[model samples]
Target: MNANELTIAEARDALAGGELSAVDLTMACLTAIDAGTPLNAFVHATPEIALDQARAADARRGADAGALNGIPLGIKDLFCTRGVASQAASNILKGFKPEYESTVTSKLFEAGAVMLGKLNMDEFAMGSSNETSCYGDAVNPWKVDDRKLTPGGSSGGSAAAVAADLCLAATGTDTGGSIRQPAAFTGIVGIKPTYGRVSRWGIVAFASSLDQAGPMTKSVRDAAILLGAMAGHDPKDSTSADIPVPDFEAALTGDIRGRKIGIPREYRMEGMPAEIEALWARGREMLADAGAEIVDISLPHTKYALPAYYVIAPAEASSNLARYDGVRYGHRARLGQGDGIVDMYEKTRAEGFGKEVQRRVMIGTYVLSAGFYDAYYNRARKVRALIKRDFDEAFAAGVDAILTPATPSSAFGLGEMADADPVAMYLNDVFTVTVNLAGLPGISVPVGLDAKGLPLGLQLIGRPWDEAGLLNHAHVLERAAGFVEKPRKWW
Candidate 1:
């Protein structure tokens, strides 16, 4: 197998044994990233940085080397990588390079991981499909015939890069299913840690309360390894959890017997595809076969999750994104003869942000406006609290985790929903937004392929700050399903 195709665990062992050189592994990934340009996965390939990091890691390889020593990773564009372009896949932030690194990236770097480049994402992390990216759509490697599919978003590029083996793993942020949805679509593992588990210090803000960075990788084990390196407490982010970071990789014992897994009846949405239903059933059966007791549970407020998430995410986005006017860093609009500060702000934003971003910003502004604040924003907050309560009740009743479909369907073709209602696209997050709203840890594990040869995944939602347990459950499911199919080398 190619060096770049090695999983994190495998590569770590090889590097430790002196069987593989860090520079060679990084070069192999750089080669893959270069050859896989058609997929648009690495929006900004950092070959020099990756090689330098790899060399440093090789020199430090000893008792002092960290868990992620020599692993090459693609960082999501949303992360603020110091001196590198961290545009968040939006034109508004074009040429904007942060003076400092995000806590997640910093942790990974401290652990000796190499940075391959910045991956594409939905502009401001606003859309369900990666089509909203200013860097152009990050095409899915899993294509059917001549049609290109979306890798799901806004972590689509991260998913594509990992699935395509351009990198062993990538950093992904989930606002509402961005990481898990893309991972599902691409037949990989993506986990969104409990809301405060990973520090969000330098990550470009989406929905502050909802956004959490996690690892997207080839397997659950790789996810665990990468996540361990990425997660830790940081004094920089106010919402960052002060809890201790556990050894996530050691938690994958694959012994899930006696665990209570909840199958929420509310997840069986109307007009759901038969394939997705079958996949969910198979996931439940697999867990049961492995000795986990599947219990029917009720998260009755699941129906309101989508609408509530839309209101809350966008509202927070509006507040977080207000700092991006023309006067500061990034793109600035040329002034007209009489254009004042207000006019410049309007013109710069109008010229910089994409249509999907503009739409969300407007919706957010309207909902947070004085007249409608109580009617929409406050109502959504109340609903979010109720959603959390539902999960709390289930956990309190001894449920270990909740099982549901990661996405309603497999990867859809790029531009397939261009003319359709935006609500149709929003429906893609139906199964995922609830996890973010409840501030719970969630993981998407590829279970099987659909009739169309596309990959499908099942979500396992865990208790807050229980990523170790969540990963073990997912590891069990992964072993049971034996989903080894890879997307054909179309890219």
Candidate 2:
């Protein structure tokens, strides 16, 4: 296999056996990134930094190497990589490079991982499709009838890069399905750990309460291997959990026999595609054949999840994004002849933020306004608690995990929903937003394909801090599904 095509586990073994050097592997990925520019997955390529780290990793290979030693990984632009451009794919943060590293990236570097560069993302992770990015959309490698598709956003770049062999694995954040949706669209594995499992410090904030970092990789095992390194408590982030991080990869025994997987009745929504239903049924059979029990359950509050999420996420986004005024850091607008500070703030924001971001901010501000807070924002929080209660009840009933379709459909074409109502786009997160709302670990594993030959993914929602078990069960599904199809290189 090509060096860039090797899974994290495969590359680790190859490097350990002296068959491949970290420098060679990093260079291979760099070469692929250069040649795959049409995909727009990598917004910046740090070949010099990558080689320097690779050389350092090479020197430490004998005795001082760490868990991710000599591994080359792509960082989502949302991560504050020290001395690298970390714009979160927004014009607002133009030319901004952090003086410090995010806890997650810092941990990865401490484990001897090399940084290839910054990957693209939806501006502040506000969109379901990658088109909201200021750097432009990251094209999905999978195409149908010559129509280019979107690797779902805002982690589209991470998913696209991994799927197209531009990186071994990349970091991604989940806020209203940014990570898992893109992974489902790109035919890769993406996991969003329970809220606070990964520290949010140094990550560009979107919806602070809902955002969580996780790994997007080629296989479930790779997700496990990377997540073990990415997770842990951090003093820097108050929301970070204080629990001990478990050995995620080692826990992948793939023995899910007797595990009860719940199939939520509310997930079977009106107008859901037949292919999605069929695939769900197939997933149930696969798990059942593997000796697991599939039980019918109901998350009665499911209908309210999307609306509540929209309200809560935007409200937090409005608060978290308030720090981007022209006075401090980032892009500042030039003052007009008689304009005051207020005008400067307005102009800077108008020029810096994209349409979708501005829209969300406005909606958030309106909802949080004194007059509307009780009706919208406050009610949403109450509904969010109920959503969490629903999951808690299911788990309390002995459901080990919940099984459902990762997405309502397969990868859709770029510009497919350009002129449509925005709610039409929000529907993409219907199957995913609840996990974030309820603060549970969730994963998307490539299971099959749709009629157009694009990839489809199945999601498994797990109990809080039970990522090891969730990944183990996903490994069983991965092996049973045997989904190894790769998109033919069209970019």
Candidate 3:
């Protein structure tokens, strides 16, 4: 029945109709996992435990199961899972299972979703490529003439697991393109909600102000279905907005016809690969063909977004990572005689955090330090506000959404750019960072593929709380573009 390729909604319907059983679905996923674990796609799998949960879900189906009842999903290790080893792909947190489950996972459980296991991610969700994980990175399921490819990060494992049909839909977090980039790499639908739309409670902090958990699904509607179950406010997270949740599933039916989509002129800059440029142009045409009016807009402060986000997110990450000082959590370095409490903290952080994490922490601390606070941190914040204002102006000018390329190029090899200078690697995030700085909702859906046969994706940026509008346009574009992304043995 190709259970691996079924959408989350389809799997649930099959289970409900008795055409499939929770145990049957779980077994197929476990079988796939057993075959793919050597690919390093998962950090851990609880098949026995997963089967137990599946049994419970099936029992509930016998009683009055809901839409998502009995579907198994892969959870990114960044989310806290009680009793499941919830390490954020780091060495220090090894064997340090959390005592509680994250809000998102908890909500999914209430909706009757089962967990296959914990998927891999970059340590502390730091790197763009999952190569920085304490565990090995996830290999892309897509192949280009026997050559290995990449599943983007820090949600690469989630993307790869879903692509490999190891799980239905997986949870992902996008601080600055983590979710969307990986989705692009694996040809899946990834949506990062407007900041504060999803509760941050129980998520291991990376860049606190920017960290947002979302869904990675096979279809936009499935993404909406999963998101509907995950979105809500929680008193535990102070930054959570108390806005009423909408039925995103119902909202998907709204038409984006006659709507306005703006193409930020600043985004189409020099050095953009030809394929990406073509995809962006094709995206605008697709929207236009679907009755959307495409406008040429300017965001002068757009170029400053990457720099500001690099500074701001690192600063927040440095603060959020301070809790991993070996006493309250994670690993702690041995204290020496005559050394004060401060030394223990310093040594612990040095030993616990990986190289990339330490590099970011130092950069963050330096920028937010007393000497450079105003010149760097404060100025960046002001620039961030200006960037958001740019979006505000565009939205006010009748732009319902913005369209752009998801990446400058398709997925590269596993280490294709690892040593070609970090600046180049960081540059890969150029297209997705601005959306984060504006605190807007953004998604990446497969638009087409490059000549190398790697997947290419289009990014959709939306106004705050306008996710419904964004998804509607995305679905319309999906059909209008006729971008069928069936890879020949790609997954």
Per-model TM-score on C-alpha atoms: 0.99, 0.99, 0.96
> Where's the lowest-lDDT run of ten residues in candidate 3?
482-491
What is residue 461's positional error in candidate 2, in angstroms? 0.2
Q: In model 1, where do residues sit more than 4 Å from their true spots?
A: none
Clashes of each: 0, 0, 0
- Minimum summed lDDT over a 10-residue window in model 2 is located at 58-67
Q: Global lDDT for candidate 3?
A: 0.86
Tell me the RMSD of model 1 versus the true structure. 0.7
lDDT of 2 by residue, 15-77 (tens): 888999999999999999998999999998899999999999988896568889989999999
**Local distance difference test, each candidate:** 0.94, 0.94, 0.86
Candidate 3, residues 332-403, lDDT tens digits: the string is: 788889988889888987877788888898899999999899999999999999998999999999999999
Compose the digit string of candidate 1's lDDT tens values, residues 200-299: 9999998899999999999999999988888888898899889998999899999999999999999998899999999999999999999999999999
Better of 2 and 3 by TM-score: 2
